[model samples]
Target: MTSLTPNTVAADAEGLTLIISGDGIGASSMLQWRGVDYPIDWIVDVDGDGGSLGSAIPASALAIDGTFETVLVTVSTGGAASNPLPVTIFGPGVGAAESAVAGAGGTVTASTGRLTATYTRAAGGYGTLTAVDYAFPTDPLLPPNPISPVAFVDLQLLDGVAGDTLVGTFLPPNPILPPNPVLPPNPVLPPSPIRLAYWTGTTWAPVSGSGAVAPTFSFDWATSSASSATVTFDMTSTPQITALGGTVIAFVSAFAFEGFSAPADSDINVAKAGRAVPLGWRILDLGGNPILNLSSSSVDVSSVRIVCESLSGEAEPLDAYAPGSSGLQNLGDGYYQWNWATEKSWAGTCRLVRFDFGDRNPDGSPIYRTAAFQFTR
Candidate 1:
């Protein structure tokens, strides 16, 4: 017995065609078409009907007796019958004319009395199809159901820091349905749910909050409207911000069905309390480890610099220290020491010193002042 691949059936005014395929069928193989045990016709491989895989059997030849919604078609070889496949038979006047049907996320095409639909399933493979019979103006035109995808229009950073709230505005897609004419028309649609995550120097971290609320970000749709929405990321609730080095915060907005949008960063610098204190006369990495300076022959010095300013009285500028500068010397293991003696005026007074090492985080944000050291000589 040969196994057959199921055939797709398409019907028209002329007749029906069973597009069939199978394995292990030779010239002597017998092919039979049947509907409910009523023998329709039999074709031998040597006959022209059975020579090709797709054999077209006319409706008249099948002798379809009466009205039937579905016809079961099967193939048989060596007296062994394959499983029957059902073909949907449209009623007389239905689907007669070329119809254009549009459904959620997809479209349908009907041409020359054949109906075919190209549809994309929504998330989780679920979708709805709405079909209507086309019979001139008598049939009311389907109300316009526009589907607008959710999107962020204006993203700005109102504030960014460990303690302050990160704020921004986004626009959700417009509603598709029409307003109710009887009851009070609700013009503004509710904002879709969203999650806020900021780019840590290393990876994306969710903006989590402390207190009774687990996640700290707040969806402030009340402050928004149909044209736009607002959200706040509470940095104080997220303890991870304390370890972050820079004031620049890059964050992203995400929707369950829409996925993530490109990252929108805060341009304004947010003040971070208790930034790492720079080591007096020393340079350190972001992790608070002293960065030792190696010998000039072994180290590339172009990227390193130190800025010192007197915090007491009027701010006095001290000559910036660099690798080749007389007072700047490299220790070992990425550590460096600045000799205050070179700047005689800067040695005796209280001063604020900042280190600028050519180091960057994985997210491309510059590793700003590892520590701000206040030195009193």
Candidate 2:
């Protein structure tokens, strides 16, 4: 069970902190806010079962300031997602309870045309960068699903403390569309803005109270920087910084993600045991052209584990046959199938097979594609 504290906020609220309390929340649990996923900072784990997750919502509702929207939030961990909670961002307000942050306000820089952008920290609280690694980002169609980002920028900060401050000006990516000096004005919709995010080995995620995965690192983000042509973000050092493997590579808020659609739950349960069942999963991107790698070559068949949940409510993983090497077939189009060597001992028990294609939500939540079977033996 999971719940949010003070689940209501002012429509124009800034610097609001939300607390999530739940049982069985894994240390790696992440929060799904609106269409974006956030990392949860655990305050305490009561006997490793329940605790309050932390997150900072500088702007209420959606990331954009002044946007009035009722946000549905959830926390996911231990292969399970908590129930949805609606945190209403209330009122059409003119209240200014929040004050501006006067940090080391730094300098001006620019981002050019490229997918991977880089920033170098200067002496003062300023830095400069240029980037634009164009990616066709998408949102995962899995539990606690989030929306896709229209345009994303792959940003990397160089130099330790000073550089990460992100206190500087940013110019638009270069090669700007040639202006039709002769043409008249045309009403055009703008692409969705990308949020400040980091790589989680699976997907791009926003930096929040939650910790970073894979590299096992952390960074201080000034959630107030508006993604405008000229933007300045105030950042500082945190106690969670790790020197090695801690190089922070930030990406725009996530969207257009990988969706696991294969090995439907209905296709798993059976009336018998000891049968070779086809248990596997399929991964898909928004468009055929994905920003992340989703292919057979990327998965290691040797890491497959068959977990058993006995009638006594006990669950553990066994070193089962590798799904790809034994009776497994590459079905193409991200479909990898494997024959389950069901054991007679599994009678009257539930069997689980999990596959982590290294795909995660923008909030750093791994999309664990799993298959399960029930034995009536």
Candidate 3:
């Protein structure tokens, strides 16, 4: 091969073509990655001699959590392998101090967490993009929904030219470790229901919608309701961000069944002294799969527990219900429910009652989805 065009790309990038401008081009020519030969997508030859050949990389083949990684690109034909050309595949999560995309000026960084994101600056991108701090620029650092956030990322940039765009795909790091942070994590595909919010000088809010919520940017969510999200940060309104070089922080929280549910995440429930209230939700893994235990009629009960706390954070365990009981049990397909019987002594008192689901993470960590509420009787 003589030359390769557009050899560099960010991790998890898609729909990109790699061009090879070399000699000995033939119909039998093919592209190879990781010793596996894939069919050439297309080719352009001149006078049947030497012309540019084209091949594409497999999906998610270049996805990585660390940067400065290199891959060798080669074209093979007639049982002979051409010389390997080094292609730089820049990754994310190389530490905040050293995290920068392979490009002219812009930089990107992410915090050390499972839920993370990687950014790609558009061709019209400009300016000095600095660090990615997980914070809100204004008061009420979080949104009103879900009560808390799984992770947050702030994209800091300045002097950005108009019409500059950025495509950021957010998912768990390592693609699958400590819980299998795999790209497009299984059972959870694109259109993942990931809750991404921006601090709108007051509270964390969603992108634009039909509710007259003024758009912060063009939200092109490629995935949702699962474990990943992709959005394009259109910098057409760069002025709104560059309030004297202030950073525009974007916060994201996944709506996986792993966190907050029962009284529906920070909600309040009214109960009678002798009434039974059902606390139930569909339990899901980080990847959005139902935690099924077909061996038993009920859902796995070993990981379920309940606790009650006072309004001032005084806590104590309450064994009102447990699995294999008369009224509390797993309903199957990862759904757990309990008809909580409110005792007469629990009436007229404000208490924070929480149900801790003992679902585990891929790394064997004691991960649990909790449902807490102000139980007022």
Model 1 per-residue lDDT tens digits across residues 1-377: 22232222233436654445566444444445554332223334634555445445666543332221234455656667664443433333232222221223432332221112222322232222211122211112222211121221111111123343322233222232222345332221112223333334444344444331322223333332233333333444442322322211222222111111111011111111222111223333222334343233332222122343422233222223232323445555444444322233333333223333322222323333322222233
lDDT comparing candidate 3 with the true structure: 0.44
lDDT of 2 by residue, 174-281 (tens): 212223445332111113223344445455444432122111112112231223332233342221222111222233322343433333335344435565555555
TM per prediction = 0.22, 0.30, 0.35
Better of 2 and 3 by lDDT: 3
lDDT (CA) for every model shown?
0.30, 0.40, 0.44
Q: Going through the candidates in order, what is the number of backbone clashes in each?
A: 12, 19, 17
Q: Which ten residues in a row have the lowest lDDT in candidate 2?
A: 94-103
TM-score of 3: 0.35
Off by over 4 Å in 3: 1-95, 98-126, 133-148, 169-171, 175-195, 207-230, 235-251, 256-274, 278-310, 313-339, 342-352, 356-377
Among all candidates shown, the one with the greatest lDDT: 3
Score residue 239 of candidate 3 by CA lDDT. 24
Off by over 4 Å in 1: 1-12, 30-32, 36-51, 61-68, 92-377
Deviation from truth (RMSD, Å), model 1: 26.4
